[model samples]
Target: MKKLIESLLRQALSALPVSRVPPDARPAEVDVERTRDAAHGDFASNLAMRLAKTTRQNPRALAEALIDALPGHPAVAKTEVAGAGFINFFLKDTAYYDEVARILADSGQYGRSDQGGGRSVLLEFVSANPTGPLHVGHGRHAAYGATLGNLLEAVGYRVTREYYVNDAGRQMEILAVSTWLRYLERCGETLEFPANGYRGDYIATIAGQLHEAVGGELRRAAAEVFSGLPADEPRGGDKDAYIDALIARARALIGTDAFRRVLSVALDDILRDIQQDLGEFGVRFDRWFSERSLEDDGSVDRALAALEKAGHAYRRDGALWFKSSAFGDEKDRVMVRDNGVKTYFASDIAYIFNKLARGFDHLLYVWGADHHGYIARLRAGLVALGGPAGCFEVRLVQFVSLYRGGEKAQMSTRSGEFVTLRDLRREVGNDAARLFYVMRSNDQHLDFDLELATSRSNENPVFYIQYAHARVASVMRQMQGRGLEHDGRQGLARLGLLVEPQEVALMKRLSQYPETVEQAALQRAPHLLVHYLRDLANDFHTNYSAHQLLVDDPALRDARLTLSLAAQTVIRNGLGILGVSAPESM
Candidate 1:
């Protein structure tokens, strides 16, 4: 209905004389919005007021002229020139009736549109390092990113979901050394683990598997492993330095080949576990991009060469530095350290380059809130490499703190004391986890109340919405039990009988779903859809209480059932996008 009105307004604008309104005065896209007050009209637009200054005409008079020129349409009952040149349009009841019919006809694809024009998007998210199992923080990334992808595709965007594996970093090295130490412990070698090592029970599990793979072949005596190691953090020394020294000693004792074997075993086990956890949670990626691939494929070298050739990089303090400060960074960043190893930023720079090279029209990076500072430098790298500024975008997801029994659960990946995504999912179920994770804006802090989420009462948003859907199904089952069949075609034909206030309100809310989906997709906000479904459910519940669907009159009964089924269809479609289940029974 909104689109039809916008088209009619455009026809009216085209009908206006060149002397009265010039081509440049016309808006590129017509803007017709639903009015707040029903007395004013159903929809309103301020085109006359917007063009008054440029055309030097009275806005009210211009509005009247535009209204007179509007094309005839059945959806629009009437048009009025409201105060200060506002064009108000009142839609006929048949307009909403047709919308309900459309909803039934389209079914699951009701609210989908081609607003995105099929532009390719590479969405990289939840690239948590394969050091340990994913914690609660990464759950937000997975849920948010997956839902965002569904929303984009719902609006016809070509979206590719990606997970970048941080397999080549100090963290990976730490995980490797940690697993090796545990492997020695399994081989009857008593040793004290480094303070910076990953202390999760999973590391010991991986070591047990490693020992099964190569029994004592890669293990050394405890004294040989820690003979000359620096003092650990427990001894008042730096934990990072001690960890680094421990990593070096591990390599020297086991040899680089044998050390890499330990690293590979740990990496494979952890990566496999991460994959299984995410898959079970319904979060799947189109690609698992390895950071090491950037180095193996010479992408990092290519990126640095491009920067150096473009004069955006120079040697400073015997290290290669990118002139990021010149491109809005607070200071220049190092591409390679003085020790002749490429820094993590070098991988970041190359990763963006690689994404662009893959022919993605846009790069949407979903990063943790702590990565805010990296946005500027990464964008600078993209711009320096001749990529469009608009092509690069980032959405920072805030931290997730889990509360159970009125206490905040502590999370530390290295300390191995954290709530994993799998743990949360197992407790609250995936439906609640998926919906609650996105119930708030990505930029805002979310306090996931487990008590509310698991409760069966109306306060639980997920349960409430699902109940509305099941309630409709219950109505149909009752109809069948009473030996009555709903005539959908007849009900659609006699939609005029649905004139009750509650019925009218449900139809109006149904009309808003398409707009809600488009807005949510364009704004990258899934919470909008969440709120919409809640409101829709509330309206449905209100209507269900006010009127009985299995009434005596067959025409009214079918009509009411048709409306109820339409509501159920929409709820299912919406929940599908959120990766949530819409059960037929609680």
Candidate 2:
């Protein structure tokens, strides 16, 4: 029905004089919307106002000309000019019912399309450093990224979900040193736990695994091991410096090769922990591109060379820096430090090239809000590496704050005091958790009120949407029990019986699912789908409450059944896009 309305609008636009709307200034699609107020007519558009200046005529006159342009389609009864310059369309009753049959006919595939024409898209998200378990803030990216992937796929874009593990740099180096320090104590050489060491209890779990792997060769008496260790406080302890010192000591005790092996084992343990946690949290990645792989492939060095050749780079303060400010960044960024260690930006530049080289048409990087400043440099890095400027889009998702029992739930990783995604799923269930992430725009901060989310009220949007689906199921059951034969099985040849005003309004909303998917994918906004689904569910409920699907009249029963089936198809399809279930019974 949405498509049909759009077609009708194009027809109207075509009929208008070339003087009013230029041949190319016309809108490609016309929307047959359900007005919030009945007095505004069934559906309205301001294309006339948009055309008035170009046509050099009053908007009201232009709107009238547009209204005169709409012909007698199988669906539109009439279109009127309203307000200053709005085209209000009134769809015929039969046209509304026709869309129901089309929707039911499409079934689960109702909203999907081949609009993307096989273009491949790469979606990278939630690339949190594997130093610890994922916190709530990362959960939003997981949800948004996954759902966006699904949305793009529905429109026919091949999408690969990826997580770039930052396992080749200082953060990982620090992690290794921290684990070794913890392992030393288990080996009986008591030492202070470095303040810079991973404070989460998960670190010890890795250390214990290292001990098991060494067959107690790393074991030590507890008294001697912790002898010089400071009490658990901010301390006179500088964790980073202490861990760096311990790393040096380990290299001495067991040559560089043996110490490197131990570090590898520790890294393996930490990486395993990360993979397990994220998997259980429902973030599935198509690829775990190792940061080391880029270095091995020479992409890092090659990318640096490109920057040098492009003259986008130079040495400053004994560091090789990319003049990112030349390309609109706040300031230049270092690709290599004075000591020759590559910066994270260098690694990312290589990774970006690797992604495009793999043949993805577009690259999307989803990062946490704290890293918002990195977008400009990353884009700059890409340009210096010969990739088109602005080809890469970096979306920063604001953090998530968890509140349980009306108080701020402290998330101090140092104290082992953060709620895991597993904990959130356990408390609120997966559906609620998924919906919570998309409840707001990605750039907007979301205050996820646990109490409100858990409540079984209209305020709980997930349940409300689900209930609409369940209610349709109930209607179907009721119609079946009434011995009413449904025309939805064999597409209804005649739908004129569905003439009620509310019926047409409901069908109009039902027909918008596909266009919503396309628009949401184009804008890279999943919240639009969220809001669209809610509106659709509300429309279904409104029709369900005011009308009966299984009326005594067979003609009416069949028509209504078609409408109900369409609603079911749309609801189910919508839930699928969100990675939520649409139960046949509930």
Best by lDDT: 1
**Residue-level lDDT tens digits of model 2 in 1-586:** 5566666677878987776578877666555565778677567787777777666679998888777777677677778888888888776666656667778777888889998898888899988777777777777888899889999999999999999988787777667766766776555566656666676777777777787788666544545334444343366656565555555555655567766666677677767866886676566899988998888889899988888988999998999999999887999999899989899899888898788678778888888888888888888777766777655887788888877668777777656678777677778877888888988999888887777778888878898898888887887777678675566543365466666767776777887788899888888888998898898888888887888777777777777777777777898888888877787665
Which stretches in model 2 have alpha-carbon errors above 4 Å? 11-34, 69-72, 219-239, 474-495, 499-502, 547-554
The 0-to-1 C-alpha lDDT of every candidate, in the order given, reads 0.92, 0.77
Error of 2 at 75 (Å): 1.8
TM-score of 2: 0.90
Please, what's the RMSD in Å of model 2? Answer: 3.3
Q: lDDT tens digits, residues 1-586, model 1? A: 6778888999999999998898988788878898888888888998888879788999999999999999988888898998888999988999999999999999999999998899999999999999999988899999999999999999999999999999997888998999999999999989888888889999999999999989979878898888877789999999999999989888888899998888999999889989998899899999999999999999999999999999999998999999998887888999999989889999999999999899999899899999998989988899999999899889999988888767877777777888899999999999999999999999998888878879999999999999999999988988999999999998998889999999999998999999989889999999999999999999999999999999999999989999999999999999999999999887
All candidates: TM-score: 0.97, 0.90
Position 17, candidate 2: lDDT:
75
Model 1's C-alpha root-mean-square deviation from the true structure amounts to 1.4
lDDT computed for candidate 2: 0.77
> Best candidate, TM-score-wise?
1
Candidate 1: segments with Cα more than 4 A from true spot:
none
The candidate 2 region of ten consecutive residues with least summed lDDT is: 224-233
